[model samples]
Structures are given as structure tokens and as C-alpha cells.
Target: MAGFANLSQAARTWSIGFMEFDPQNAFNNAGAVLRQLSALLVSYSLSFVGAVLLLVIGYLVAGLVERWLNAALAHIHGFDLTLRNFFSKIARYAILVLVFIMVLGQFGVQTASIIAAIGAVGLAIGLALQGTLQNIAAGVMLLVLRPFRIGEDVQVGSIRGTINEIGLFATSLHTSDGLYILAPNSSLWSQPVTNYTRNQTRSNAITVRIKPDADIDQAQRALIRLAQSDSRVLADKTPSASVSEVADDAVTLTLTYWTAVGDFGGTKNDLTKRAKLTLDQQGLSKV
Candidate 1:
């Protein structure tokens, strides 16, 4: 009977301690905090995944559109493939910028005000670069006109070089000294441009002075032979070598011939060197 009474008292004391501890209330608050944390983690994960997917979709869309337009415009009656590649790149980049803006917007950013501020800043920057902007405008005109293109040798603004690239605001030229010279299109547009590659073949004229005492007839024959022997020289254009000037010490003979544009510089050098050698071999003298 005493053992049963002690067990009943112990049970009553344990029940009182449980009420004071409040285990159910504690678990309820803990479970709510866990749910909030889990929701936040899921939201952050979704946002990150969404950003990545947006960027990938943007790139693929831009690429496909760029490729399609490039091909279509290249085959258009009045357009050039170079122009197609150029404009397509610009469009693609523009699209990418827009996509980037959208991604930023997804992160709860106020893009409109940001874009407005950017526009204002861009306007200030543009004002600062007025001259460069003019060059860019002129470059657009040059590309449209297509006065010259890559690999074409041209003379503009007292500078001569092979055109390596035609960018938005500047033109790159590889000079004879192996230097790349970027000439602004505003200056290029204002100046006269001479494109040597406009025609398939070009005329090369060589002027050599010989002693006045030398026979003009015999010297003419020698120079003509020198001009004619080269395989690259064309005959249909009517090659000629004649006494063009009678100076105090020498008679200048100008030999004019036609050769492929590819051989412009090489042929000129080879012809000059070989002609001098041939004249010396024949005992011809300007001395």
C-alpha cells in the first residue's frame, strides 16, 4: 500500500514539471522558424537558376537571329557580306545588353530609373566625345558607300596602307613599315581616297635616265625588251617606252606596262631591279 501511494505522487510531480517546461509550445515556434528559413533558401535558389537560364536563352536567341539576318542580307542585291557581318554583330551585342538589363530587373532592381540615369550619363559622355562621334557617323557612311574594304590598298589623308579592318569609328591600316595606323573616318571621309585595287589590273610606269650621248633608239629598244619579257606583264593595254624628257645630264625614258593588281609592288620592284641589271649588262650608261 505505501509503494502504490509513492508511485501516484511521483506521477503528479512529473505532470506539473511538463506543464512548466511547455515542450509543445517550444516545438511549435521552432517548426515555424524552420519553415521560414526553408522558404528563403528555395526563393534564393530559384532566383539564381532563373538568372542563369535567362542568360543562356538570350545568347541562343541572339546568335540564331544574327546568323539568319547575316545570311539573308548578304545575298540581298545591294548589300555586301562584310556589312552583314558588321551590322549583325552590333545587333547581337545590343540584344545581349538588353538581356542583361532584364536579368538585373529580375533581382528586384529599379531598371527604368537606372536606365534613365545611364542615358543621362551616356549623353554627357557623348557630348564629351563629339569629335569621335562624328568619326563614327562618317564611318557608317564609308561602310555604306563601300569606297574600299579589307585587303584593299588605299591612299587617304597623305597616308597610304593596306586596309586591315574597318571599325565603327576608325579604320585600321597596316603601313609599309609594319605599323598599324588607325585613321579616323571623319578625316578619311573629308579627304580624297584613291583605291588601287578598284581594277583587276593596274598600270606601272618606270622612269629611267640614261646618258644623253646614248642612242635613244637603242635605249628605247632595251627598256621595251625589259618591260615585255616579264610573264606577269599584259600586252593588250599597249606597252610603251619612249624618251619622255631630255635633261641636262640624261634622257629619261618612261616605260609603262600593265600587270595584275596582286603583282603591283612585287612586279614594280622586280622590273626595276632587272631593268637596271639588263642596262648594265648591255654596257648602257647614264654616267
Candidate 2:
């Protein structure tokens, strides 16, 4: 209140000096005071107008962005979350940046030179971090093609593990041995990748042995029966067992079965165990 009273008096009273003044000097001093007051009012009005205009434009842009996001990103997973953050902040900041630049231009500031200076600095920084820039580019490519994502068990180069995250420079994986590995994006992009979980089914080949005296026909029948009876095994294609090789004391047989991905290992182990028990009961060799 005190400050406001003092400013009000300052604007109201503009006597130039205590000494007597000529008419011309008196007119000049009063003109100077009125000009200062007019400038102050113009500055305040423009600032208020800019703020209100910014709010209105911001609201309208927000509505348009929301509608466009819904229409454009309907099929994308996590798109709402991603673009909600991206657009709201990016658009509003862009508006503010433009407004600020325009206001500066009105005050006789050169924006092009400022922009050029920033670009030059960015170019220098990019050149200094060339390797990091390549990694970021590779990461973008991987994300776009989506060769593998988090939770897929993949083999890249000599590394085999479930991917945990994909970042700007590296992909993190959790190995079967319970170790975490950070693979550079450049390396991942350079290697051949195999994603095991991409398919719903997996086939495994099991090698078993039987006595030479045992009927090859009976052993094949038992192997097929073992695979068929197991609920996890896929039976549309018949499980096959054949005399693949002849060992010194046993006939080596190869049994191949198709199973669901989740049951691959368990089905193989169960089938192998059941084949052993059936062979033993039939007096086949333990080999």
C-alpha cells in the first residue's frame, strides 16, 4: 500500500526542479513525465494481453491435440501415455517459445542469430559424441522395427537372455544365470537376433538307445505312445522314432516330438523317462 501510494504520487507530481524554470523547460519536463507514464501503461497492458492470449491459445491447442491423439493413435499400445506427455508439454512449450521470441523481436532482438548460435553449439556437441549419437540412432531403429522387446528370451551374438529394457544406448537383459547384462545398441544392431518366444510351439529331438535284440517295431510303437499320451505334446503330426545309428552295444534311436513352448522341456524330460521305464520293463538294455 505504501509503495503503491508513492508510485501514484510520483506519476502525478512531475515538477522538474526546485529552481524557477522557463516555460520551455517546464513543458519539456511535463512531457517527459507523461511519456514515462504512458510507456508504463503500455508495458503493463501488453504483458496482461500476452498472458491472456497465451491461455486461450493454449486451451484450444490442448483440445485439438487431445482429439488428434485419440484419432491417430487408436491402435498403438501405451500411445495415450506417451503422447499425452509428449504433446502437452511440447506444444505448450513451443507456443511459449514462439511467444517469447516474438516479444523479443518486438523489442528489437534478432532471433535468427540466436537460433544459429544454438545450432552451432549443438553441432559441436554432436561431433564430440559421435559414438553415442550412433548408438542412439541404432536404438531408434531397433525400437521402430521391434526385433525384440522386454520379456522376450532372445539370443544376440553370444548373449542369451530375456530382454529387460531397451534404452537410448543399450538394451538390458537378464540371463539364465541370474546375471544382468547391458548390451550396446550398436552391437545388437550388428548381430543376428533369435527370439525364442516369438512362436507358440517348439520341437525337440530326443536320442534314446535300446538293445539290438529288442524289436525296433515295438520300441517305435512305445515311443509314439509315450508322446501321444502326454497332454502337453502335440499329436497332429505323429511323433517319430527311427534307428538313427548303431552303437557298439545298443541301437541308437532318435525320437522327435512337437510340444507347446511352455511345456517343451518338461515334455521332453517326461517322454524320455517313460521310454526308459517301458524299455526296462521289456528287458531292453539300460543304454
Question: Which candidate wins on lDDT?
Answer: 1
Question: Please, what is the TM-score per model?
Answer: 0.60, 0.69
Tens-place lDDT digits, model 1, residues 64-160: 9899889888777757555688789988988898888888887878999878987999999999999989987888888889898889989997889
Tens digits of lDDT, candidate 2, 51-159 = 6676667667766765675556556764434334444555656666666665556545798987788689989999999999888778867876788877889999899
Q: RMSD in angstroms, candidate 1?
A: 10.2
C-alpha local distance difference test of each model:
0.86, 0.79
lDDT of 2 at 18: 38
